[model samples]
Target: MQRRTWVPIATGIVALVFFALPSEEPLRGFLPDWVSLVLIYWTFALPARMMVGMAWSVGLVVDIVSFGLPGAYALSKAVLVYLARVLALRVRTYPLWQQTIVVLGLLGIEALILTLIDFIVSGDLSGLQRWTAVVVGALVWPVVYWILRRARHLARLGH
Candidate 1:
């Protein structure tokens, strides 16, 4: 992979580690979904390179780490990336709030898809708690974007 590719991959790995860390509180549930935010950002910014299969693979790793229903996140991430790609042009033109709204919507759909899969596989509804994490991720989107943009800017300067 090129040097530019490593940044997003490394970011994804760090996100996976953060999400995989054990936690006792209810808020800990949201960590796994952070990868969706990272993926969306990169998908929009680098659509030529960040393909759906890559998203699916990253999602699979998250699934393995979280020990959730297998393939749940993999499928969701694939869909998220697909939507991001389809909407990339329009999304890039929108203001930050509009972009965040779109991301929030995508995150919600991802959560719903994962919940449906978990329900079908486990026949249990306990995964609803994970929605809180999605909500938190949505609320934090602007800050996440700002940080990511700054990092990208710094990386450009370094190069």
Candidate 2:
């Protein structure tokens, strides 16, 4: 793979390791859905290369690490990446607020998918409690976008 492709893949591997580590609270409570944020940024910044399969693989890794229902996160992330790719042109032109709204909508769908999967596997609705994470994720989208934009700019400069 090219060096540019390796950057996100390496960061993704690190993120997977980070999420796999133990924590005081439940694994779900501590992790900030960093994988989703990274995928979103990469999808916008480099959609020509970051495919849905890549996002799905990262989601599967997350599912394994977090001990949640298998394929739950994978499906959600794949769908999110697909949507981001499809709407990238329109989304790229919008203001930050509009972009944030779009990200929030995507997060909401992801949360619902996870909830449904958890409910299907566990026969309970406890997954609904994790909605806070989605809200926090939505609120943090702008900051993540800014950081990723700057990082991409610097990486290009270094080239």
* lDDT scores in order: 0.79, 0.77
- Number of residue pairs clashing in candidate 1, backbone atoms closer than 3 angstroms, sequence gap of 3 or more or interchain: 0
Number of the top TM-score candidate? 1
lDDT of 1 by residue, 83-140 (tens): 9999887788899989988988898899888778878887877865677777788888
Off by over 4 Å in 1: 1-3, 30-32, 157-159
Q: What's the TM-score of every candidate structure?
A: 0.88, 0.84
What are the per-residue Cα lDDT tens digits for candidate 2 across 117-150? 8777877887544677777777888988887777
Q: Candidate 1's error at 155, in angstroms? A: 3.7
Q: What's the C-alpha lDDT at position 83 in model 2?
A: 89
Every model: Cα RMSD to truth: 2.9, 3.2
* Best candidate according to lDDT: 1
Error of 1 at 20 (Å): 1.1
